[model samples]
Target: MRKSIIAAAFASLAILPAAASGAEEPPHVDYSFAGVFGTFDPVQLQRGFQVYKEVCAACHSLKFVAFRNLGDAGGPHFTEAEVKALAAGYDVAAIDNETGEATTRKGLPSDHIPAPFPNEIAAKAANNGSAPPDLSLMAKAREGNASYIHAILTGYDHPVPEGVQVPEGGNYNPYFPGGVIAMPKPLSDGQVEYADASVPRTVDQYAKDVSAFLMWTAEPKMEVRKRVGFGAILFLGALSVLLYLSYRRVWRNVDH
Candidate 1:
């Protein structure tokens, strides 16, 4: 009996590697905002916001972001009026002062983005027992960040490989862990009309744009932080040069 149990354990351990092998590494993308000097593209960020509002918002939420962030420097840079107008369209939770009862009011630029569902339980109930993750920090939280998102979004194009069995309500995506994902293919060609006529209206573009936008949401102040770091580097470099000159001058007459 003990031998049989040990054999069963070994067999399970052997299966683990095979299961893990199903998920493929996401392809690298040369995003504009990739390196130390990276900067977010305002136009792309705007388009991504549109995609999020029209499609992803139905299932996922950007609960950490606010309407005012749309107008912040180094972001989408939507005008103040536009931000206010957009905020007014959404109803946010509030409490009535007179009645002391829970209610809702039009969203304000200051308010955090509201979730599609009131809570996790409702979100799960609406999405086949699997709650769609909040996309606010998804870019930062995931292993490959934006690239992983792009891969998962476009990975649905291929048919399931042989010997793979996708469970009910689960979709096969080699980019997704365990070779299955709860969410179906969300983006399709020409699904959302782009205001910019130059950009292609395709799934790949949509995925890329949204991925960049999510990255911005994850690190809204990334540009500012980068700028500060660069400035500090310059200051330190100047200080080092000055100190070296002073040391040479001070030790010139008393050389060791």
Candidate 2:
């Protein structure tokens, strides 16, 4: 009789409402932009820049970037003159040697935008205990790197089935720690239009572009590395062919 009562109690508990059960699942979003793994698109990079400037800049700091670097091969592909013109809109600070003060100067190739918070202490204080990580090396620092970012961006989802138990304010993400994250999805399809028609205005397109730009920022010499690697392979292939020909010639006279 006791076992029967206990089973009935458990079955009743299982049928409780989601709120009563304190159950909610993390949001699931489709993060596969373009395909499983896609290279960076310059057209999308420009649109991402627009999104960052208009939305993300309010809370985040891209401290490592100079306005001029936007014209790099993997960047927005801004022209030299266009970059110069764009850089002119922002002011950068320099140490004034004569007065022992940091003075503001128009942004130049040498200057990086000062961080929003003076230091980590101030940054954490400003962000409700969540430190806005310096995105300078994010693409390189994280494992599975670009794919991880793409997944996280689109992982928002609705609650799980009723009666399921999920922690408060915790959303489900297979990639994030504990399947929960404090940050919400930041990109949406058509949220920001691309100035260049070559790039599609999709969430995946934006994610790929920004991720690529971040990767380039992390390793500016990547293109050069690719070129060097290709050249070496070609040289080695030619050398192998020459050696094979020489070996054949040397043995031609002796072999039956």
Candidate 3:
């Protein structure tokens, strides 16, 4: 027992340095949809889309998603016309099939979400040689869930430490892996007028909404998955009761 105590003490000492290494941690946020039964708040998702459109889309892309996805079942559920209007706001490059030449066309619901830059070189040039990642899977890609994402968005105000220097066109974010981020702080309070007047125009509100939207993009079928899982559990529960009854009845006649 004494030897075990000594070993445990040594282990704690070994771990103490890592725990107290002074790396910054992300703040906590309680999301409405997080667990098995959680459902996406469509209104919040819509607001997030607005944030992305007006703000983040300038550098980031949602390349895997189609504009029509916004109108799909279990999504933000924008109407077909609304999706069309949203798509029309951006233009996409297309090849003229008959002429074999490239052409610019109004974005369509069938088209993938367009990137702000035509290619990686343009994106890199605009963003200091580091292109912003496609955000379709960011909510899933980051180890820090919504809270981590929200913290990174809202945690940019900390002043640079006296010994540290931020690179040109770079910004300081404590939550960023290296405490330096290529993307400047993209959100500010009252940055955009929300479609819903009731939604608050604040950095935190924008972060939460956009984080939730990215979560949906990461798992578009979450609602359906949860519903199907619930139905399967109910069916299994009923089947188990029926099977037990059958066993009891059959055994009743054949006493041990």
Per-prediction TM-score: 0.88, 0.70, 0.86
- Worst 10-residue lDDT window for candidate 3 reads 17-26
TM-score of 3: 0.86
Clashes of 2: 5
- Total clashing pairs for each candidate: 0, 5, 0
* lDDT of each residue in 1-256, candidate 2, tens digit only: 9999999998877776433423233333232223323334566566666766655555567778877678877456788887777677677667887998988777775566456677788877766666677766777786556666666665565444455454654455555654556554677888776667776777776766666556666765565666677789999999999999999998998956
lDDT of 3 by residue, 168-213 (tens): 8889887877778898889999998987788899999999999989
Lowest-sum lDDT 10-residue window in model 2: 27-36
lDDT of 1 at 146: 94
Candidate 1's C-alpha runs over 4 A off are 1-22, 96-101
Off by over 4 Å in 3: 1-23, 161-165, 254-256
lDDT values, one for every candidate: 0.92, 0.65, 0.87
| Candidate 1 lDDT tens digits, 127-209 | 88999999999999978999999999999977888998989999999899888899989999999999888999999999999
Cα deviation in Å at residue 157, candidate 3?
1.1
lDDT of model number 3: 0.87
- List the RMSD of every prediction in angstroms: 5.8, 10.1, 3.5
Better model by TM-score, 1 or 3? 1
